[model samples]
Target: MSAESLERRTRNYLNNNVPQIQDHGGHFEVEDVDEETGEVTVAIGGACSGCGIAPMTMNAIKHRLPDEVSDISKVTVRQANGPRAAVMPNKTDEMEAMEEYQDYNPPF
Candidate 1:
């Protein structure tokens, strides 16, 4: 029930749950965990962050996170401006980069 363990387990859980959440364009990153109660705080990112279905996305993550990680007693999704802001897209770096690359049109 430590911060490090909480962080690790949260990331692991997210990794496994990614495929399921992907349909909704849901994604998350483990920011930090509470050392005392092992509360895992996640940052909801990607298209799920800023979508009409974001509320559903939040619920899905809330339900799945705890069941996926045993030590996690509480899960907090950080919504900064456009993060978990209920109307913001905060995709992971790789995902965003790939998307950018995909959309890129080279000037030949």
Candidate 2:
């Protein structure tokens, strides 16, 4: 396939998958894809910044992306906020609650 098509495919996949990731208070983005090197860089943000499960999530992305987007020999996951930020040291209960509330849904 052409490089242009490969890039498009990668972008489309990211667009579709990012929302699912965001639902967990984490953000995912496609940073770059090098056609020649076959390296794709992805950025993770929000609650996923420094979370321990980041590796698992990244690994899943790396595996899934290549399956969908051809020519991607490698996937690099970048953290927007450092690992420590994932813990949000200074975040208070009310602040955390508010953030959660904004994304909450009523079970009923």
Candidate 3:
């Protein structure tokens, strides 16, 4: 397929899959897609940044992008972490939440 065709397919796939991430309380926005390299660079915003589910998004967004466009070979995700951003509720809250999630009393 042509480069233009590849770009369109990749863009469409990205746009389609991003909304589904809402189930995980996260979202992805595709910033730019390189047809030649099959590299997609996207920004993770909203509930995704500091959420407990952020890490999983790495695979969901980065790994699957290439599936959309056959020519896409790589995906680069860039995150924007800011003090006052909505993604960050607060440092103390974030740390506490992570710790709590880590501490588990497993069933024998």
Candidate 4:
């Protein structure tokens, strides 16, 4: 299949099967496709940055994409976020403290 058609179908598959990703402010981009090797790379971005479940989402993509898209035999997914000046941008101090102490249990 042509690269354009492959990409289009892949996008459609993700949109149809994984609407939750978009619902949660995440998005997937088809970064590249190697027709000969049948490998595709996808970048997951937006609210997926620093998300605890992003790995699970990536795993799902790696397993599902090839099955759903023709000419795709392998999948590679990466977080699209580059280096940030501050970790967890827009996170309030309260949020940070909550995350830091989420597993803590006082002896009481």
Winner by TM-score? 4
TM-score of 3: 0.58
What does the lDDT read for residue 54 in candidate 2?
A: 60
lDDT (tens digit, per residue) of candidate 1 on 1-108: 556777787777677656544565656677777777867777765655566434444556666687777877777775434524465443443443575545532121
Clash pairs, candidate 2, are 50-83
Off by over 4 Å in 3: 1-7, 22-26, 82-108
**What does the lDDT read for residue 68 in candidate 2?**
72
* lDDT tens per residue, model 2, 64-91: 7877777899888867765445553333
TM-score of each: 0.60, 0.62, 0.58, 0.73
lDDT of 2 at 94: 52
Write candidate 3's Cα lDDT for 1-108 as tens digits: 666676677667756656545655656666676666666677776666766545555556676766655777888876655563465443433543676745532111
- Per-residue alpha-carbon lDDT of model 4 for 23-107, expressed as tens digits? 8787889899787788888998877775665666777788878877878989999889666311344333344367674653312
Cα lDDT for residue 33, candidate 2: 68
Question: What is residue 3's positional error in candidate 2, in angstroms?
Answer: 5.5
Q: Once model 1 is optimally superposed onto the true structure by TM-score, how far is the C-alpha of residue 53 displaced, in angstroms? A: 1.2
Per-candidate clash tally: 5, 1, 2, 0
RMSD values for the candidates in order, in angstroms, are 11.4, 8.7, 6.9, 8.8
Superposition error at 36 for model 3 (Å): 2.4
